[model samples]
Target: MPSSTQVQLVRRPRGWPTEEDFRTVSVELGDLAPGQVRVRNEFLSVDPYMRGRMNDGPSYAPPYALGETMTGAAVGRVEESTSDELPVGALVLHGLGWRDVTQADASAFRRVEEIPGGPSSLHLGLFGMPGLTAYAGLTAVAGLREGERVFVSGAAGAVGTAAGQIARLLGARTVIGSAGSAEKVALLTSRYGYDVALNYKEAPIREQLRAAAPEGIDVFFDNVGGDHLEAALDVLNPNGRAAVCGSISAYNDSAPKPGPDNLSRIVTRTLTLRGFLVGQHPDLADEYREAVTRWFAAGELAYDETVVDGVENAVTAFLSMLRGGNTGKMVVRV
Candidate 1:
């Protein structure tokens, strides 16, 4: 038998979670049953959505139960296996969070490959769910067409970075992004090929968006909902499309903030706004992976990662991402 270190949810957090909400404890692993494999976790993901899970309420996914292991996506190495589909020493990625090791049914894990020198924490980011979310949300949901103007909020984070580059690849005539800082704005425009980038915190978002998308935006990839969504709604062209991804601006709020007063724009302009959960669109996964792989291979797309070391720092990374402290996908290396 082996023992694994795991982090369990000790309490449901009211606002932002703290270390007291979690408990790091050791668990003994019993003998693996048929179709089960033991995995030694290498890296784990700390994403904004996890915050929703920490609260005691119904969401797109189930909230984490008190006294249960805190759940998330993780990349690990198969230490032992009793299933034909999974072999010992194979690197895999799965939704196994905040633990040094895990034992899950083979079907719960997928082998992670093509990572030279083995996959780093980046696999759970750029080439994983976050990247897929951006790719699919833009093309499949937003109907991003060639020569259209695109605007993205939270444009320097994981999905935002990918969304901007993918929009460019899809022949968007102009790409604009808004981030928290001037440095991130520079990164979006200069490094990621966004035509116009604004620091939303320093200037009025509506005014900056007006300047950025002077012709009116054809597509708006929304990440921060409150004011950013309001700003985008005001500038949408007739028949414009908007993809509603994560709304981080409102994620930590204790009360609902007022949204776009101009939601009527959606009706009058015949604009479309669609919300998405990445798991709900599994039909687009293969296509997204193929397209992104080609773009990455050809140097047409790029990715960034902000990694915090160890499971103990997972909370820090999560908080940082919500505060726009990261330029791309935020990951934790265990």
Candidate 2:
């Protein structure tokens, strides 16, 4: 029997998750049964939505069971296999994250095609769920149009980076981004294809947004809510659309935060503000993968990964990502 080390949730967090809330345990694995595969994870994703699962509340996904291994998205290689469909050495993407090794029904793992000159971990970032979220949110939810001006909050993070670049690729006249630090702001414009970038910490977001998109924005891809949402509401053009992909700003709040006071603008401007979970839009997956892969191959789309080595550091990476420590997708290399 092989032993695997896994991170388990020991406590539901009150606000920010602490190291004490998680525990690492080594467990012995039983012999693989028919239709089962064991994988050695190469990369594991740490995302903002995972924070919602850590709390004992109703969410789009079920809460993490206490004292069980935490699960997210992971890319790995099949180390042992008892199924013809999943042979040894096959690279696979699955939802068995936060662990160095995992064994499950072969049906739970999907084989990933290798991208030429690209790391397989891209499946967890650019060519995977986050990328799909960006595509669907912009095309379906926000109804982005050519020559439109767009704004994105949390613009240096995974989905934000993709959303901004996709907007430009789709013919947006101006793409504006907001980040927490000067470095991220620079990366937004210089690397992520944003026409304008603002450090939200430097000034009032409403003022910065107005200055960046002086003509008013046609689309707003909101990753951080609260003040960012309020600022977008103030500057959105009439009939502007907002794709509310996340509310990471309030993810760690212990108490209920006030709703955006400027929400009245939605009624007056006839704006469309809609929240979405990527899981609800799986119908767009094929189209998203094709477009993003084509853009990546053509050198028109770029992505970044902030990797923390080792499963022992997965919790640390997750907490750091929640605090805006990562410029792009934050992942753990196991």
> What lDDT, from 0 to 1, does candidate 1 have?
0.86
TM of each candidate vs. truth: 0.96, 0.99
Tens digit of lDDT per residue, candidate 1, span 81-108?
Answer: 9999989988898988888889979999
Best by lDDT: 2
Pairing residues by index, what is the TM-score of model 1? 0.96
CA error at residue 36 for candidate 1, angstroms: 1.9
Candidate 2 vs. true structure, TM-score: 0.99
Q: Name model 1 segments beyond 4 Å from true.
A: 116-118
lDDT of each: 0.86, 0.93
